[model samples]
Target: MVGSLVNSSLVGCDFSSSPTSRKPIVLAHGARRGDVVALSSIEALPTLAAFGEWLRKPGPWVGGFDFPFGLPRELVEHLGWPLEWQACMAHYAGLSRDEIREIFRAFCDGRPAGGKFAHRAFDRRAGSSPSMKWVNPPVAWMLHAAVPLLLAAGVDLPGLRPGDPARVALEAYPGLLARELIGRRSYKSDDRARQTPDRLIARKDLLARLETGQTRLALRLKLTHPQRDALVDDASGDRIDAVLCLVQAAWAEREGPPGWGLPPDLDPLEGWIVSA
Candidate 1:
């Protein structure tokens, strides 16, 4: 696979809408080393464009981005959004934040609370994480809006797309991983300034798993002195997302994906990453 250079470790990403957002890029960098990579990181980025530009630039990487690749086929069909990825991106991009929320709300209103919206099968495995949820994370819209941009601009998504699959993209659900470890604790963060001590504690426990490589989905991270402190300091999960992405990069480096880890029934236009 073109993304073979990515590394055995998989980094988890917590994405933002644009550059202006204070949301720091979280990454879970992993490699064979002293290994504190599982802990949350607080990395900096000037802008969303700068971040996107980095994805195409190149390095050993494979990102398990915490976003959706495409909306539910059933949901899109019901809402009557454009059926194709390209057209869907245009349609999603065209909507204002308010308008998008309204449409999502209307869609939610029709369904039961727990059954409010449909989800991908992978999401079922991912559990009740909102980031994985089609409606909550709007990852489907993410796939709709972001993937084309990524493909056109030249990011890698091995076993999924041709050309340089350096920045192999996957719909990672940290919440899926987190829920198993921490359960219903408040892990997601909205404000950089408001990150609480509880988050730091949770990060500490999370780091234990990465250090010992306790879980089946463990990351191998090599953190610099600065990197370690930076990760330790982050109370919110943004910087941690970047660290997660680094771990994902390492995982891709280790694993070989023939089809970006997707099922045969998966949509080609939708794309997916291979899972172990």
Candidate 2:
């Protein structure tokens, strides 16, 4: 554990490349004290500009961002993008969304039906959507919108890039942790009509497990009554997903930096998710 990071600010962001008021980028801000991570507040950034501004805030903080920091190395190689991390990101950021979709679509067109998308080494372990996937989740666009801001903000991404060590950034996927607590249980839905009682019950059960520190992280979630209720009531699950990321951030902080509990041999072109 890094002594300097004890009780330091921690953030977990559930991001959207194209954010709007209805489905804004949600941030769960908290800190770890001993084995408990206390929820301080939840914030929503309704635009990419707001999210960019938030990234530039002074740090000595660690953030677990729910976005892909890098694309699959296989995809990068196939498209002949820069092999180096920084250069690859620079080239990727230079292209428009349309261009990205066109190129990715062509790439998929060349592959077989079932294995159309190239995956990063950690994708299977984390159970996350492929970073190259531009639809459904649109994580590819999320990567496009986010990595440039992180680069501009000078945050350190362990095992990938080096910058401001105080402002540590790690790729996070809430599904990894959520699956540990509730296997294949759907706890949320964006559509109001689909927010069924069973889903709400699942959310409550998930929260119960988290509060009891039942997951492998073994860190209890400290939430006020209202905070607890808000997580359960948010049918979209964005808020709870952010909190799930917050817990991952806390675990990474406890493990300290450089690897941050990720495998030391992680691909520089496809960063591993923390705690995956």
Candidate 3:
């Protein structure tokens, strides 16, 4: 079980070359709770080893980390990569960027029928998962970045045993909420100029929905103006990703605390839950 004292936290991370480590910096919202002003830390990484240490300590957190945790097995298998997780990771780690691209390109070529060569879900509607075979969701990358550290730190997933529960991580898809509120019209923005008033209005409306727990997942959360603005200010939607994590954390708290329904032997590196 997680401690009675729970932290409602959201962390938005831009991933780096070292999968398990974080860089390009990490921005944590709600780390201290009580309505936050800005993300806690953001910085470039000098080394993967250092980034690994930082990833685990980013908080007392029930976080929504913005990243994909699973890859389409089709793509992996097609690449003639190892079927097993460990072997696949080793293969991936050893390859250069060009090798990965060439391999991925070949796999995508002459792909299967069924409008599903790449997997991505823009909308959260029923069976909306686009496909799993995407190389970029880099769910494989997500796994490489996360799971090992959690296992070493003694965190457990849904399938784990009691002795193995400490930290908790969930694969949270921010697009879940984005798609829910705005459908598939591209709510993600990186250009400050693109942070148009229309998008801000959309985010405001979305926040209202989250506050009311107005969706299938039944998540109710409170957000201060500062929190709301912080999200709105981030043109890249990173802040909103953290907010999505906040909603997930809120729902998880309602069910139990840190250690509820988590699986054993689940990959910490690869985490997934509702897109929201």
Candidate 4:
């Protein structure tokens, strides 16, 4: 927002609800000096509290975080929840996980077979799961857990909020970039047994494309040899997902606009995904 506010630092977060040492939240921090975007570090926040503190730290950063910032407007309205984003989130925060699941289940039960999940406008474009879905991906819970923290952190969410221009948070989906490089290819798995050679190869190819600037974003990723190995060796793909978001964060910095590549008619209550 100022001449001094050049793109200096960026971050990508692969978040988790109840992160432990085994499945910690991965944070990728990068800095852009000229054209090269260097991954300065990858840190793990083993608890939700730790991640919250990290986000609140002073920054002239544009972070692309891998979490849904809002629920579907359709779901919120149908459930008689608040239409305003802040009020809807406050209402959501008061409910337990079980309560959320039961309410969402009832909404789905009343819908037709193929239309069970109500989607935000950006969901289809970004190839993301419905924001109300509580299981499988549990992105519903991610929103339940993450948005409150974002609000508490008071970072600007572009079209969504005006908290801190110095600390900008954009909703990012790594699958969008990964899918762009390798369609429907599974590159990571939680189960050790499922981490196959082919998936590893896909990760390598994906990273290669990123470094070579194969994306429409026209930004090449710069990672050290150790950083490259760390990204590929982690079979969970959390590290790689964080890097994907880092690239998105860098792109957001370059866009330098009101919405930063989000849809012009983007719903304020249901925020759009960056680079969708």
| Cα lDDT tens digits for candidate 4, 227-262 | 999999999999999999999887877776566777
lDDT of 1 by residue, 174-246 (tens): 5655554566676546676657788777776665454455555565444566765666676666665565545
Model 2 C-alpha lDDT per residue in residues 20-42, reported as the tens digit of each score: 99999999999998899999999
Error of 3 at 57 (Å): 2.7
* Order of candidate numbers by lDDT, starting with the best: 2, 4, 1, 3
lDDT by candidate, in order shown: 0.56, 0.92, 0.50, 0.88
lDDT (Cα, tens digit) per residue for candidate 3, span 1-276: 444335444444444435333224344444433322224443444455565676556344544445544444556656676766545555666766556656656665666666435543322332324333335444445545554554445433442222232344555556665566566655557576787877777777776666666765555555667766766666566556656654554444444444443344344322235332
Error of model 4, residue 15, in angstroms = 0.8
lDDT, residue 219, model 1: 51
Candidate 1 CA-lDDT value: 0.56
The C-alpha stretches of model 4 lying farther than 4 A from their native spots are 1-4
Model 2 collision count? 0
Q: Which ranges in model 3 have alpha carbons more than 4 Å from their true place?
A: 1-26, 29-51, 58-60, 112-164, 256-271
Query: Per-candidate TM vs. native?
Result: 0.74, 0.97, 0.67, 0.96
Which one is best on lDDT?
Answer: 2
Any idea what lDDT model 4 has? 0.88
Worst 10 residues of 2 by lDDT: 1-10
Clashes of 4: 0
